[model samples]
Target: MENRIDFVNWLDPDMSIQILTCLDDLSDLLRVTCVSRCWRQYVIANGLCRQLCLRMFPQLSKVVHVVEQRYGTKDPAEVGSSNFMEWQNLEREHRAYAFLARGCTTFPIRDLISEPICASSTDNYPEESIDNTLEPRDVVAQRASYWSSKGNSNPAEPEMLLYKLMGDLCVITEVSIQPFEAYFQWGLPIYSAKAVRFRMGHPKSPVDVPLGESYKDYENKFIWTYTSQEFPMAQENRLQTFKLPEPVLCIGGFLLIELLGRVQRQDMDGLFYIWFAPSSLFNCSFLVFMVNCCELFQDQCASTLIEYFVILAIIFSHNVYVTDQL
Candidate 1:
């Protein structure tokens, strides 16, 4: 019988690349690299992951700025001397895209704050406290109550709620808010806001101040890193998610939700009640697994997860803002 080579070995580099390009799943690509030393080297050396990342998130093209800034002053001869550094850059891009994708898939929800502290408010109903918003949706013991602001019909005047994130940097994709509908009341009308705006930043001063103590003067104490365009909210009682135009990189770990417009009043008390759901931070285990297996290349997967894995959680006080009419 005539001797025949294995299918993968028989294929030329170009043909191999063409076949690998058909794989859309990152997991499949990772597995393919493990098939052989030749395949692993081919995948990394050819920057297939970088190509895949670019295809997935075209915005990553902006990474050119990062590359230029990092290597701008390097000698041309040194830069061209070895492809190792180029491969490393591609690996970083690949890892970042993978992490982002993983985050989008698994929306691990958690309450950033156990109880939010009300900062500045026109009025506070003892029963309708700011802490009411943080209660779990399924809690059967407590009826659905919400954080309400005093009657203010002005669109320019807005109520604000501040939350502090204590975890590592989080790439926020969406924020959700629910309007409280008094079902037991005569008419089950929803108390919705005209619009909502978000701001994220780091506090200029230390945030160690006690919940309701020093936060009364928090407005001027923080520096905003990002401000989102106003998003119109629905007049519905159910949970509504407002997706950001693009994912925001929240570095400073403070989120400010600004409620715009007056509450649609049903009774003499012209107030708006917001049924806030606990904000969820996306956490994915696959990202950690991939980082350990693909990036570290160490058999010590257990240690890798312990060292690099981080879960997102928010820690803050029960502070509400009741703004006066502007």
Candidate 2:
């Protein structure tokens, strides 16, 4: 009589797969791998970790393949059988997917704007400056603050805001914007655009893009990695969120905001204006996870250096004593 229980043997393979697919947490999947040798093999061979990651974030499907970057590793050619090679491939997938899932689920949230680059046009130099948008509050120094575009007789003339992110690489997920309401004006119109679009990219050259200046083909300076769909903006004096279709891997760290159409007209000037506070970029950086590991490596290198120097000192001392005695 069989004393040990094996669920995989008792149930159909499809049933077993269905049961495992229900697991959503990476920790739980990891625990499943630890149950027994057979269990570990089953999980890895089926590529469950990769499947779980793809299920949670379909955006990751863009990753065509996973290539290991491990150094000080020998080529698998000398160590191989067909079965062993297959198992190695499965093992690599298991580790890669697990790390991807962890990063996607656990990155920290923070505002990623380094500085406001420029606005297409400014209505007032000091009072309605683009820099004021960086201040979170609408009021600064006891005065209502906002960045306003130059009024245009053509309502269709779009406006733009450009900003530099905190780092050279970023995974941007969302953006926050607030339309400026001119409380001081009659009817208290909120100067919100009809629609908004976002683009993420890097500069064409290292130092070609000039500050406080722009050219006719200003976009030529950037190589955009991601461009979001145009989302309708509400005409309200409140913070609005525009979440990306997928988390964008922004290589060049520059962000562009396009305000598509003008909604409100200034009664005194009979022209349309786009007014907004400085927007915030929400992102997670891969650099954060690797910092601790880099610190650990640095500490180990320091210890090794100390040990190496002590060994050299002892050898030198022994040689000097022998020479003097002779």
lDDT of each: 0.55, 0.69
Per-residue alpha-carbon lDDT of candidate 2 for residues 188-302, written as tens digits (9 for 90 to 100): 9999999999887666665445454432347666666577899999999888888887666554568899989999999998999998854433232222111011111223533
- Model 2, position 322, has a per-residue lDDT of 9
Residue 5, model 1: lDDT of 71
Top candidate on lDDT is 2
What is the Å distance of residue 159 in model 2 from its true position? 3.8
Off by over 4 Å in 2: 1-15, 71-86, 115-131, 136-145, 160-174, 183-188, 197-232, 242-258, 278-326
TM-score to native of every candidate shown: 0.53, 0.65
Task: Output the number of the TM-score-best candidate.
Answer: 2
Candidate 1: Cα lDDT at 76: 31
- Provide the lDDT at 108 for model 2: 58
All candidates: CA RMSD in angstroms? 10.6, 12.3
